[model samples]
Target: MISFIWSPGNPLPAGTGGSENYTVGQVRELTRRGVPAQVVTVGLGTDDGRDDFVDIPFLSLPTLAAVGALDGTVVFVNEPHPVPTRRPAFLILHNPPPIREQHRAFAIEGTRDRALIATSRYAASLWSSYLDVDVSTINVVYPFAEPCFAAQARPDNRTGTTRVLFAGRLSPEKGIYTLLETLHIDVIEQDVALTFTATTAGADKPQGKIIERLLREHPAITVVTTRRTPASMAALMTEHDIVVMPSNSQYWHETFGIVSIEAQHSGCRVIASDDGGLPETDCGGVLLIAPDNAETLAWGIRAAIDSGPLSLSARRYAGMRFTVEQSVDTLLTVFAQPQPSPPATIIRQLEELILAPSVEAAHTVRVPTGTTA
Candidate 1:
């Protein structure tokens, strides 16, 4: 039996974004495998809004504390708890914990800012160097893909050379600027069109400088700022042939990219930045490009587009790599980790993780480094 005490990305099932998608995907995978999986979330998230995944009563976060404790709970959280203490718990960190100056999270729980939430060796190195702690403790569970294959391929309604799409928050750190600026004059010159999809908050925010740059230069590319319901997002992704990720953030590394997985499950090739946890997305047929470089991104995009048969290959590759059944299998392994016999093992470990020495660092806060961070 595996269950999570989680807070949604925004509490609004659909609009809340990536973390919610993760929670739903994880829960669906586990339960389908016959493991009991529960998510402790906010009140029907009614005040927050709704999504296909967040609409149910089971996903609700209980207001009572005792109920949370009764279940052999595994706390799968995106952020650090301000108050640190132990009850049977395992944390699923979305952002790498900071190892620098103390921030607000220290108030909730005594968790190391630079604590390891590694899904790979490269990520482990970043945590050790940045947080000054042993990286071994960070769990290395590769993120699971969204579980919907309802989005089958379709004929391109727009006509001309068929193309896939990249949809997400278009920010400078997200590498949209790099991809748009560096695409070959010939490639940009091509009749290939683009539809950049992002939610309303990102559209309204000041962070969209990269998107602004893309719009200013590429008239052929259309920038879409409309928010989609969960069904809409699934439909949109399935309709396209490729999904592009051009992240170029200096500090905000993508911990795990669900968008890449969504694209893959929907039978789309994913062109992504070769940074952070994106390489793990390789398991799903993601074509990696150097971070912060536009020429490379454009080159990657063009290559995926030109291969003609690459889209079908990528879709098949992703299907082999990611599955709800495999995701559940991994979770069962995490849950069966010999449950520290000493009983207080978790409490003791938290003590050490919290006490690790701090260092001078960049922004210690973890925000939107990836789809669910």
Candidate 2:
């Protein structure tokens, strides 16, 4: 039996976050496949535990210890929680963790029957280099778009004003501030009516005061504060001519741009900063912008506005590559693979530090032919 354990704080189904959505979709798809897969969620609003996925009050050590007693269970942990289980387990690395956090995680989780799974090749390479582990040992499993995120109908871009959208976090790293700066250039908003959807309210409201001031000052930019479901978000994407993700590399490089993929899948021409795993998500469905440069971003946005909605081929490529079916199939293949040896046994060579390139040099973007502006 395969069990997916989410954080004690996260909710299921109605939860708006990426990891939450992935878990919900994975469990549902697995159930449909007749796989003995279940989810262990918390704060689900129901105590009945009537669903195939069980609801626990919290993921305390006691709870995990109790779970350890279960037989024939293979666990997949979404968050960094050490399950005190004898059963084999895999840690899903959705994003890159800070060095201290990684150390703490390794200390608690140990290396036995525990293997790492990264969401992108960039992430796998990052972790492998940071931890001095073999990159090949870490499996790269790309996330999938939910059915609701698919393109229903492409928006006609020849209308009066081109509608441009900025979805996801309002943090500095997410480049909301940078995007705001781009508006200072008159060419950016010429025929474009920009929309900023506050999809995530960042960790402890990063740059809250500045973002608030930006939104208040730019009243012409439509602010969609209404909480959106996957279906609604997809519909919202379809309504827009272009979607921009100007992620900055200075803070945390984007691990994977899930929203970028979903936007493209919904036929919105995506313009993204080629930071970390963002290029992987964009694939053949985006216009690449160099990280942290407002001029380049503004240029990309203007180009996208002029270019109009994504071509039919771009939308089709996104749908085929980032579907739930593909993700689920890849996950099943990972599960079928034999258990990996402990990471502790792997030698960490000091020579790597002298040999490997600098961090900035490592995360540099090289846009592919079809995906570039």
- The backbone clash count of each candidate, in order, is 17, 0
Tens digit per residue, CA lDDT, model 2, 1-373: 6677655544443423466557667777887787766666544434423242343122222354455665555455555556566756777777675646646566334433467888889988987786567789888878877777665776565556667787766667678878877877776655346544444334235475567556766855666653445677778788887788888888688778788788878888888987899888875669998988889988898787678667788677778777888988988888788756755433334455668886765566788888954
Q: Write the per-residue lDDT of candidate 1 for residues 247-303, one digit (tens) a residue.
A: 765767877676777677776778899888777777445788888877777677777
| lDDT of the candidates, in the order given | 0.58, 0.68
Q: List the lowest-lDDT window of 10 residues for candidate 1.
A: 107-116
Candidate whose lDDT is highest: 2
* Residue 185 displacement in candidate 2 (angstroms): 2.0
Model 1 regions more than 4 Å off: 1-3, 7-17, 42-70, 82-86, 98-100, 104-109, 112-121, 128-133, 156-158, 183-187, 190-201, 204-218, 225-231, 311-314, 339-373
Best by TM-score: 2
